[model samples]
Target: MSAETRVVLRRAAASDAAAAADVWLRSFAAALPTVVRPRSDDEVRDHIRDVVVPLRETWVAEVADRGGMGGIVGLMVLDGDLLSQLYLAPEWRGRGIGDRFVALAKRRSPRGLTLWTFQVNKPAHRFYERHGFVAVEFTDGSANEEREPDVRYVWQP
Candidate 1:
């Protein structure tokens, strides 16, 4: 299937919790190998299902493959001015889905937005920078669950 034909972005619903969690688990496993203490699949799944999906403004990207079966492949969670989470399935990276999700967050908070990403996630740092976010702070990894060094990026209109 063409890339354009494969993905759909939408506001996440309660029914999407499981699929969203699946994307979260898969993406986290594939992307965050340097995390000092990564959560188990079950634990991540539970948090996505119970806490993130219900409590955050979440968006999901659904992908339909050649066989026409489709499932959630990406997710973004925004909390107030913070872009708290953004992840895409391994196959979905390099597409513009993440940019679209970030644009949505910017639209929702046009004045400004901020996000924290692990310093080791160079791809994410580049992505945010490409979207006009500037690195504003660097943290020594003490405050996060993974205890990985991190950077904060901010976007202002």
Candidate 2:
């Protein structure tokens, strides 16, 4: 499958902080009910705001028109040789946004990259697989509220 919808990706600014936080919370929380279902929305949002949001520089994906709310449809956080928080909105899944995010992360992180995904998130597993990432380790679970097993993925350029 390919991305039929067009999107624009760019570096995020400090002004995007709050909205980006909301984007991560909304998107991940939505996914939670399905995989490793979180105990509460507040906990999920707390993880986003406290952990994921402040951890990395984020890239935002917006509709090509450049108008409307154009909230962050996708995001990426690169920390040295790691690619963290590479999430695309559910509606944007299966489109090329994720591939683009991965490509950008790889380009920005030529030393190699790694990421952690919920063990049961098959879609993400398959997506990472297609991007040439291999499972490197599996943890019993995150210390975070989800309490789900996590799989680590690594890609070497």
Candidate 3:
């Protein structure tokens, strides 16, 4: 799909867990090649469905295809003021969906929002920076599941 394609962002439903999990896995694989992902695909899928979807305030972005069917292309998860996850399909990156997701998070949490990204994910750093997030802390990879160095970014309105 083109950058101009209309993307509908809404609260994620239980039925959307699978598609959102797919986006999450694909985005992680494409964006964080250097980080070690320890979870098997099935494990990640189950976590998304059982843990993330049920516990987090999640949103999904859906795009209408030419065939008139809508497909989930991206998703964001917020836990309190923490932007825990934001992922878009590989074909949907650089199309302002990420920006929209960040905007939604900011709107929902007017006080502030914070997130962590692997230090090796330079593209994510740039994306977050462009959206007004500033790096507040850096870690030596001990705190996260992947055991990769990470940077924490915060945005305050």
Candidate 4:
């Protein structure tokens, strides 16, 4: 699935907050073997305030080479060495966009990279494995445990 696809990876600005949230909810909800709350118009705005706004850096992935105005296919939040909330639109999956975003996150966090995924998201677990992340821990107490347990993975290189 790797075609040397060119995607614009750049620091997300305050102006792009809404679009980024849109893509996040869309992709988050569409991922397989997991359940995400369906974000309403209000919820989307609330997420931007509660989640995205707090990240150290929110990076946006766009197909446009110059990073011009367009849809955000994927995004990643860098919290020190931890790469939290990496998501890509379902339509963009398998296109290597998520892989590129992961690479960007790792580069941004050279100390290491860690993230969590629903234990049931086998495809995402495999994707992380392919990127050198190994599961280090698991938790069955997440509020969403009714859907699936959660596993934490880390890559230290």
CA lDDT scores, all candidates in order = 0.89, 0.74, 0.92, 0.76
User: Model 1, which residues run further than 4 Å from truth?
Assistant: 1-4, 65-67
Model 2 sits at a Cα RMSD from the real structure of 3.4
Q: Which digits, one per residue and each the tens of the lDDT, describe model 4 over residues 1-157?
A: 2333456778877777777787777776677534645457577767775667555677888765443535677777877777867878778888877888888888787878888888778888999999999999988835552445788999998
lDDT of 3: 0.92
What's the ranking of the predictions by lDDT, best on top?
A: 3, 1, 4, 2
lDDT of 2 by residue, 78-117 (tens): 7778786876677777778889999998889887899999
C-alpha RMSD (angstroms) for model 4: 3.5
Worst window of 10 by summed lDDT in candidate 3: 1-10
On a 0 to 1 TM-score scale, where does candidate 4 land against the true structure? 0.81
RMSD of each: 1.7, 3.4, 1.5, 3.5
For residue 98, give model 4's deviation from the true position in Å. 1.5
Winner by TM-score: 3
